[model samples]
Target chain A: MSSCGVLVVAGTHGNEVNAPWLLQQWQANPDLIDAAGLAVQKVIGNPEALRRRCRYVDRDLNRCFLPEQLEQGASGLEFQRAGELLRLHGPSGEQPCAVAIDLHSTTAAMGNSLVVYGRRPADLALAALVQGALGLPIYLHEADAQQTGFLVESWPCGLVIEVGPVPQGLLNAGVVEQTRLGLESCLRALYQVRQELARLPDALVVHRHLGSRDLPKAENGEPQALVHPELQGRDWQNIASTQAMFRAADGTDRCEAWVGGEIPVFVNEAAYAEKSIAFSLTRREVWPVEPNWLLALKQLLAAA
Target chain B: MSSCGVLVVAGTHGNEVNAPWLLQQWQANPDLIDAAGLAVQKVIGNPEALRRRCRYVDRDLNRCFLPEQLEQGASGLEFQRAGELLRLHGPSGEQPCAVAIDLHSTTAAMGNSLVVYGRRPADLALAALVQGALGLPIYLHEADAQQTGFLVESWPCGLVIEVGPVPQGLLNAGVVEQTRLGLESCLRALYQVRQELARLPDALVVHRHLGSRDLPKAENGEPQALVHPELQGRDWQNIASTQAMFRAADGTDRCEAWVGGEIPVFVNEAAYAEKSIAFSLTRREVWPVEPNWLLALKQLLAAA
Candidate 1:
């Protein structure tokens, strides 16, 4: 089945400024990004939120793509925007999108990684290709009901390019350059897949999302402890029960809450405080790539 | 000379979450802050903005202390908040604050510094004493009409305790500890001043405010260039005109825009983008401390 094109969305959360700035640069100079003759459509995910330089207007736009969201009338700014975006770039919309790659930056020390929601064939193929090419880690985000409705879920094949250790609404050179490289790399892989010249790696490594943990809080929802200094920037590191994961108000270590052998991602993400998620735990896994996954990606890219 | 108690203000910009978190801990456990038996009243600068986890409600609350702001009827959330704060903690209010130490955190690479506005004798003396003890670099901000009405400027003897390189609304242990140590050091200085035993530094080192530089922009108020990779995190370092200070959209070095010998501070400060200030220039100077400054501090703290 043919599709519209590749939809490259940036600034889904307004406060993630680096990706949006790169998008603007790409818009101005089409040659800046090496799309390699593919029809790439660049878009700002949340223009209103970006204008205000905040994460969102009413609710997180990234979390607005659930099936149940569109069934109700739009009430908030993000709710309305989610509907408008679908009308313009949904699979069956005027601009009908074949695949989506959402660009995002985080306050956590998450470096550059691909966030693939669920185990979709095309998504796995694309993430594996990028990981093979760039040696970047894959975050297989699935089975967390508390974190659903990702913006990329609206497309046939989609994933998120998340880079970090940078602050919200601040442009950093390192972040911009990494984002530029990751995006161009994705486009190059897509072009190769279109011509059936793509090479799929034998094994894919991913940090499977297990659950999220909030900082210990009081009845009034104020955090009783903070992510311990030892664990603040130690994202993707394995921890043991003897390790200190949190710090009490008195500056003493709180180790009783440690999850042994559990790897943490998005450690102390600044925006996660709103969701009460100081960090989320994951389990590292290795899996063999399925042949059907590469076929799905080829089909999707041919449509693009 | 009997005066009111020392006022410690936090959350002045609301988005600066580290210092405020320290304040909450201090409030819960008064012993957390070493006030040295001197009366210290902790206050939140902007409660509404803090609740929203934003820098300000309407205008920047730090800029709401100008004389004309209070003369007019309060309109914006920050304006009303400024008035309310003064009514409760101002020099002539029921609490009658003596010295104000406004705590702030920034996105810039500035690490643990003091910001003294103008050369108020008391402010300078207090800053110099802290400098003698902590060896912190002081940024003497003055003669910049564009930047005024700081929250600490209202008190007789006050200066800003600024720590940074941390993201807004995020708490880091280094920032928290620096703020705590700086605030405690100032309190120790004041205690010495009360007993007329404070030893003001012979010569104070400061980065005098020279001017500010904004990234090249279009008429639409959008930045055309970013802070150069070589200069982004090099705050407080002297730059030569030959050095590349900004990068063009194509990643080429833009050296022609560099200002020679201009030490920049607040480089790439996230909030300053709203005011079009990418980085501010400064000139380092060493000045002998005047005896009158010590006398002024003594007179002010003798009543504390």
Candidate 2:
């Protein structure tokens, strides 16, 4: 049996304090560990500005992963710090059995979501388990070659969890809770997968859709009635066509669906404007995953 | 006549020492007097890492022009420094008559080149004059909406020059002399444009092409070749078709030409990609310009 290791990457965008706060809180709670039988390597993506409730001091740590930048030592403070963490805890040349989760949050009024990227069976299985446990929608966005440069992208299996907007009202407490729950759920899901591959499918496919939000109303009048789509669990599918099905908010009319699909599986965003949804499917076999080429190019450039 | 101002942006990427070094030297020189008939502003993009001879300390300052990131103050050190410079020297609530030239250099090889990006006719004329004076090819790359975060993009008209590769040798007197000469040449070109535009043609058309250097034979005795297409220039209204043409190194087989009018302008490697060429057409006209959308978006997000 492969020895499982979990890498919990928190604060990828320095301003999202909840992820790091949660990890720190969990570290102080020994009881939480006793309940979850999993070992985790927690990494704070950017600590410099997190102390001041700022996003970052120098650059967006998320987007500066090109190889030439690294070679020139031009990376921001946060990226350099994160690179140090990767050097210390990332997979060795021997290839450890591990999974990486990069924690983030959206500026939009999005609900809790997990963006599962990469094409590894283990990763898909883990994503499905986490979705099932958290009950939050799973958004399966294809990692564009140019956009995959985070430390998690280097791993064979990885997921990025956008925990919605950070609850500013509760400050550190909210950040801590969200982070703790997320990490715990991921570990539990990974454990379940390790113990029961026979019961689970080889992969889980997810489709995502975007919607626009209703605007605020005038002072003298009540806000216009806003009706949202009712998503019935039965409407979800494991395998389906990749076309985007556009429906009226109140289900009054059916519009054309946008083009979407992959050869062996069909996954897409199911929700409309104002909100986003993802659909998932399970498959038995897929091609062997390789390191992302765009990322490799960026790394080469930075190194050059 | 609109009062034209020149913003000399230096250190866009921290590793390119020639940019900031030249700017600093010019700043201290007595010859760079306003009496020379130009309102000049020297702005440093990333001062922190530039001092260290590294590319950047936190992030690539050039890529962090997104509105939300700027609003949240989520940026690398270089980004912050650039932002500060923008705030200090950028146009106020009212539009200003100014042009910016962000300095840069290539890492691959030594070729002095100029890059002009934007859709304005006046901008095109200015670019043409500079190219003519500098004796360099003009690469006309279309401005993508996503790339709107650059400071030059923030301005209505701007130019980026790849003077040459950063010399690996120390800051010798000869290196300084070469740097001074490059800066002076650019300044002279800009001054000439401001003084001579009325006498110049209503539209300027220049033909350009790209070439690559063939590397020496490897141990296996196979010669290395760099392949790319040649670009031809024609009047925008009179061209039969804007198509790309190519000529290989061996001078044997000529590749087919591509239709070009709708394509964006780009130079693979201005100085060092062996034999790179640039082609452009310049016409005169006026345009209404606005603040960079990314910068505006940052403000909007901050207010929200």
Best by DockQ: 1
Q: How much is the lDDT of residue B162 in candidate 1?
A: 87
Go through the candidates in order and give each one's C-alpha lDDT.
0.85, 0.46
Residues A218-302 of candidate 1: C-alpha lDDT, one tens digit per residue: 7877677788888888888877678777786577877666666679999988988888888888988999999999999887766
Which is the leading candidate under TM-score?
1
Per-residue lDDT of B302 in model 1: 64
Which digits, one per residue and each the tens of the lDDT, describe model 2 over residues A75-135?
5686686556556655552323256778876422334556665544555555666655776
Native-referenced Cα lDDT, model 2: 0.46
Candidate 2 chain A: 10-residue stretch with minimal lDDT? A265-274
Alpha-carbon deviation at B52 in model 2, angstroms: 25
Q: TM-score of predicted model 1?
A: 0.95
